[model samples]
Target chain A: MIILIIIGMSLVTMIPRVIPAFVIEKMQFRPWVNRWLSAIPYAALGALIFPGILSVNPDKSQIGLLGGIVAVILAYIGLNVVLVVIGAIITVYFLSL
Target chain B: MTDKAEIYSSTAVHMIKRGFITGIPIMLGYLPVAITYGVLAKQAGMTLMELTLMSVMVFAGASQFMGVNMIAVGTGTLEIIIATFVLNFRHFIMSLSFMNQLRELKLKWKIPLSLGLTDESFAVSSINKDEAKMEKGAFFYGTIISIAYLSWIIGSFLGGVLGDVIPDRLSQSMGIALYAMFIGLLIPSIKKEKKIAVIALFAMLIHALCIQLGMSTGWAIVAGTIIGGMSGIYLLKEDVA
Candidate 1:
């Protein structure tokens, strides 16, 4: 049963992703359809960062907020992405402690 | 056509190397979190085989975490599947977006490639999409996905073994890196496009309000994406006009 659930989860998780790859390109999409597609990443990332990050930590939950701020500041300045992530993690760790 | 084929065949190895190089940072980034997953999974009473199976089959971070949590709590199988599907609905959008760039590749490559489309690889692939020929692009994407896949599995397996030794505080702190990476990815786009800024703000506000109104995480993310993506398209249309 557990095995079946894992398989089912994998199938459900993957189908939405895999189906689109095969289908979307076959249909000649409009420019705005294309634009909205490009826009999805930024929109998804933006959405994930906000309310998602806000509720992350269990202890010292405020650290998530501060960490996000640190990330925004560091990323805004055009630091390397790896550096930005490290910077935020360090900031969150210190402030939380 | 022959020239294009020749060029593609010749460039494949170089693109793979580039993909490998691009994947290194993301691989490094995934290590701590993947390990954290293993450690947590172990703590949740999952056997090593089960733990490995989860990482291998799922390969998604957030969903795996939720899957383990649900399993521990004895949530219904259908519920676990649905929740995970919802959390990962973003990938459908990602796949569609990437499809435009990857149209030149054969169906075989696209199928496997989509299976490996984690958030990290998608960001890396899209950011670097236009740098080279289309085949090269596929190889680059393949490399990134392959390396990330290898590292993530290894990290999780090791964490399952060594999770007992890692201190709680350090493990907890490492969790911040993924969020930081998301911000890092967003910053560049926001710098290039003012419309992205508007879309981001819209998404964030909608998501925050959804949460405040007590919606589920899945629903909140869906709300945010639609509002954000629609507003972005509208803004881009206005800019073009």
Candidate 2:
């Protein structure tokens, strides 16, 4: 039963990825589809990053917001990636104290 | 001398080199996170071998951490598996892009390579403009798996042996590494277009609203994806028009 559940779950997980591969290999995408496909990754990344920036706590407080601001500001100015993160973490740590 | 054999050998070398270079940050970050995963797995009564295999076969970082945490908290297998599935859904989107670009490789190579595609590998590989497609794929995929495999091994070993000594404060600090990496990626994209800035701001607003409304993390991700994706499509259309 456990094996069957794993297999079932894997199939569901794998099919979404595999379908597009078959589609792309077999057919020429419409121009709009191509553009949309290109946008998917950047969009997906934005989705992931924003929430992380907003709340380190369940209450959605000011510290995470402030830290995010510092991080985004530094990131926009072409600061080092490691530095931007260090700055954000420091901002959060200090604000919490 | 067969040219194909030479190409294959060179590709292997490139893969290992790229793997090591791109994996440095991940190596730093993974030690803590993977160890956390291991400790939680052990606390949940998972044998060392079971923990190691999970790391080997399913090297996803966040999901594994959450899975073991859930197990430690006495969650059922069904819930643990479901949460893991939800967390890894992003890989489907990533894999599609990789597959389309990797038209040169056979399924044998592509299958395992696709499984190894993580955010770190995707970020590094997608940025490289000059490498040959198959070689880049091999390199990027190898880079991801090599670090991931090592982290899992070392993390589990450390957790199994020294689980009691690690401080919670240090374990929590690992989260900062991800934010730092994001800042790195964002800076370049921000320079490229005003539209990217707008999309990022828009996504952040939606994320804030989701948090304010008390949405769960999973739902927040869904909301952000929809808002960001729609805004990207809109912005691109405006630019073209």
The lDDT leader among the candidates is: 1
Candidate 2: residue A84 Cα off by (Å): 4.0
Which candidate has the highest TM-score of all?
Answer: 1
Residue pairs clashing, model 2 = B19-B143
Can you write out model 1's per-residue Cα lDDT over B1-241, one digit (the tens) per residue? 9998888787887887777877776786788888888988888788888888888998888899999898888899999999988888878877887776677777888898898888787877776656424545777888888998888898889889888555667667767777788888788877887777887788888888888899877778777877787776667763331
- TM-scores for all predictions: 0.90, 0.77
| All models, RMSD in angstroms | 2.8, 4.1
Tell me the docking grade of candidate 2.
acceptable
lDDT of 2 by residue, B1-241 (tens): 6898898878788777865766665566567667777787788777777677666656666666676677667666687677767766667766665665564666655666666655555544443323435554666555665776687578876786677556665455445556556556655775776676676667667766887898766556556655665676657663331
In candidate 1 the C-alpha lDDT for residue B238 amounts to 35
Candidate 1, residue A15: Cα displacement in angstroms equals 1.0
